[model samples]
Target: MNITVCNPLLRTPLSLIVDDSCPVINLTYYWIHQRHAWKARHQPNIAPERWEGDTIQLKKIPPTIPADFAWEWAEWCWENGVKGKFSLIPYPAGIGRVDEGFPDFPTREYQAWLRIYRELIWPSFDLTPEMLTHTAVVDLDTFTLTEAWEQVEWVDPPVDNRLTDYIIIAMEMLDNVGIPCEGVTSPGAFGKRQEAAYARAVLTASQHVNNNPRPFYFLWLKHDELPDVPIWYPDKEKGVAIASIVSCAGDWFGGWTGYDLGDADRFITEDLQGGCLPPILEKELPCVLVGHWPGFYFNGEKSGFEILKTVKARLDAYDPDGTKTLWMKNSEIGHYWMARELTKLTVMEEPPQIHLSTQFPTANFTLALDTPVRHIQVNGWDLREVHSRRDFQTDTFLVEGKQTFVAFDLEVGKTELELIVA
Candidate 1:
């Protein structure tokens, strides 16, 4: 019998990745001024035009996004079933530690924001630290931040131990605030050049802090020709791995600064003939949408959030019943990918059985077979066959036309699926 592994419930996976996100701090507003200072201290005096410009644009943008705005966004995602990754800058621009408190904000205000994040956002979103500081790299010994940007430090050399230590510190900061991280989001192409070392560091730190054997990161954003699956960095001998989750679409909702107002049509047109998502879905790849935290605020316009709403509405129109798409958190995607890649499946014609040896346990695991089946037994336990895909669940199988789909809670070790052909 010919068999294939399919996406959860045979539907395409959809996820989102937000960068430069923090609690109350608007990264765009801070980074602009901070970059100027860092560059001025550089030996070659490498400063960009944007850094040289006065803070005149600052008048239009707020210094902080505020807790109320964050609450509004969090509530929307909760009601809409939108799930993905969110970054928390442990020490945003070296301004303050999240576990401690920002110098500018009152202690009560900072604590209130943390409560909002830990309670409302933590449940639905995979919390990740975008390095220790989004702007400058911190010297652990001195507890002082270097003049070099975090991105520059990532590309400098192959300092595996040092990098791992840095990641541990970032993860620890979040952990101290009771938000454990299973992965990390690179800040401004951080670890782009040294991906292997970066992945190792991420896995080490994540496992050390959260005890997650499988960790993931979001670094590369490909506007075109996006990857259908995560690029894996595995250490099979140690039974630990990391997923380099790639963002397929551009930050079209709003720019990193929330200054550039992007059109929703770039993601999905009103007519549905164009945009990046349709093609990604057509290819049966995960439409990992990309955005920035500041952009969602749209400099207090909330225009970026509006764009997201339109895009979600258009997507809902595209898959009205949710039969065609499966919404997943970034960590869930990483876990599923790990199981998909590591699981060993064997078919035997003697008694019509399919054996699965999975390294990682995953939920809503689905398998497809060309043959029709009247009954299925998972290691001698009879699986209940569902009539429809929507009704499919753990230890349940569905037969649609000439294909047979099996859904189950995939567990570690060997699972034998004995089939009775129709």
Candidate 2:
């Protein structure tokens, strides 16, 4: 007697077979505190240092000021395939005496620095308001600021209107300074309630201030479990979502305390292979590495910077053809991840078109097509095709037998795209 058995497995979903050829690497430089960095590096003797029995806390400080060094670093990023997000604060940590009036911008020196940032650095890096003052609480009513040690962490279950007011003030100040603040980095940790409250306030304020309701991403460094992908902090009441990108690496500046490039290398590799690649292979999430401004430079040399370059070189060697690795700014990574999370794609065979819709219609998204594309018409208009093999800046990539990838802006309503396959 013969017996036959039926199998239950079926074909894999197209969505599950997302293109894994493009892997993203994002860098976030935290505690940028540019003014403070300059002061600390230039006048180390006068700069505040935490004194212990055997050692002073500040270590491996830069020899000269950081302006030129920062400019050089930006230029290097432009030349190399690196992009990052910078945490910016209007006032340095210890800007004035405890009783001094709240710090304001357009200082002659800082204005000049802002010009440099706008012209040179802004293109390669996205800026986040690291808070108005890195460590002080400014009384909005009296315009008085308190010392760093005197202030406490912005409350976990934040004061009713204080967090909102603080966020708006920071955004407005960055705006006035001509810096586009797309996201924010919390100065310290927040509890679940605090995170939710903060998310609600950011959503409400961003909509009113910018007139564009884009998702705001909050970069938080410390996490007990390493995040496999960007975690979503959704405020259900407010209908807003904040993507929290985890830092897989230690503060590289902390290397001065004992950690070295080997530690950095291990962390970078873990983030690339353990943290980022697995998600990209399965869920299409990007990997973001966090560092500090001081960490990259030490005693007139690029300490963390050199380590990063070495890692990039290793990554390039690992993927020689450059099909599987992408260097992206923090904002770009956030945009793509947000778009992917919100997007819905439907293929209609009746009219032979692909329909794409998203909760965030105004956001931009990248589509990696497995099939050969002869033409693409977006919203009934044929998209202009530019055939170029430029490195670093090229938007299109080739995969599996001349597959086409295109980045397009999604509209609020249904976006119809006609793809004529070759």
Candidate 3:
């Protein structure tokens, strides 16, 4: 049977291919990789007795467990059949405590890792959220080699744990080796920034990455934060939508802020769990998975083939009828290489000649790209933005104190969006 699905944003119907690619899941590792490494011995060095570190525990996993807390979360994602992968963006600030136990600089392996991130990882992932590194070992001037060894053995952090670039590298490696991957982020990169990124992504997508039919996502294409992102997507307090500068998930209540969804959220929650994703799925907008934990790294390899299992679980729940279209996660995306290799999905698209504008309180406004874009959003209400803009072109967007979604295209006529917040 021809699987022709209706495109919500485009208002057209299109045939979809076998939906092999999983919806993007940003963060897999909740606390740290140690949990997965503890007891399980994903590696020889991870044996229980050998386990020696003050690690983080998954939020839900109780402190009483005392074991590798992160593992439980990984297991949760794995069990859920969610290919929720974590990015390797390092919070060097978190290193203060980790470094206290070490004698000094990292060993040769770590040095090699540093080089890999700088040379291969960074370029590969096109990472954001800059990382800070400290690769120095301090030795006691009066201590002998044996004494130094006794006091401090080795200082080695996972390549991915130390950087987001490594996370991309690992995901890319897995994709190269036939492993399905997804990338995630917290609420940080979700809202307004995501909108701009999507705009940029669409702009880049229309170009057809390196002559490839798919899209190309340059991590740092340009900082949308250049002017200042706004909180227009979700309103948290209203039990519905609010400001969304950059948000991972758009459910105002279910999102990061932890506000209870009144009616709309209830509807979406019911839709997702009921195995009938919201009609919102019809929108062409590429939504992001926001609830991800950082610190899952890979060596261009995915061990413990659990990705498919997780994917099945989410698929079974997210799209029982197989109508919604999803995009790959950030980490799983290496210069949008995965985007190119992914199966040809049957999502609908529209001509990229429209703009979706949202107004802020004080003469401030936000805008999105669309072609003859419809303005159905209820201002000061639902955290609404353009679902998807199929018809996009190359042009500079302008923003002032309030974020503006400018749609640029070298088309027959000049297309624009102006948000006059009154």
Off by over 4 Å in 2: 1-64, 94-109, 147-152, 155-159, 190-193, 222-241, 253-262, 268-284, 359-364, 368-376, 381-407, 420-422
Error of 3 at 364 (Å): 41
- Backbone clash tally (model 3): 47
Model 2 over residues 240-357: C-alpha lDDT tens digits? Answer: 4555545544454324222233344454353456423344323423445555554465335667667666655655554566544566556555555555566667877655577876
The worst-scoring run of ten residues by lDDT in candidate 3 lies at: 14-23
Query: In candidate 1, what are the lDDT values of residues 281-348, reduced to their tens digit?
Result: 88788888889988999888999999999998998999887778887889888888887888888999
Q: Count the backbone clashes (under 3 Å) in each candidate.
A: 0, 0, 47
TM-score of each candidate structure, all chains considered together = 0.95, 0.69, 0.29
Q: Model 3, which residues run further than 4 Å from truth? A: 1-67, 97-267, 271-279, 292-315, 321-327, 331-422
Q: Measured by C-alpha RMSD in angstroms, how accurate is candidate 2?
A: 10.1
In candidate 3, residue 365 scores what lDDT? 20
The predicted structure with the larger lDDT, 2 or 3, is 2
Q: Clash number for model 2?
A: 0
**Candidate lDDT values, in order:** 0.83, 0.49, 0.26
Candidate scoring better on lDDT of 1 and 2: 1
User: What's the true lDDT of residue 93 in model 1?
Assistant: 81
Q: Which of candidates 1 and 3 reaches a greater TM-score?
A: 1
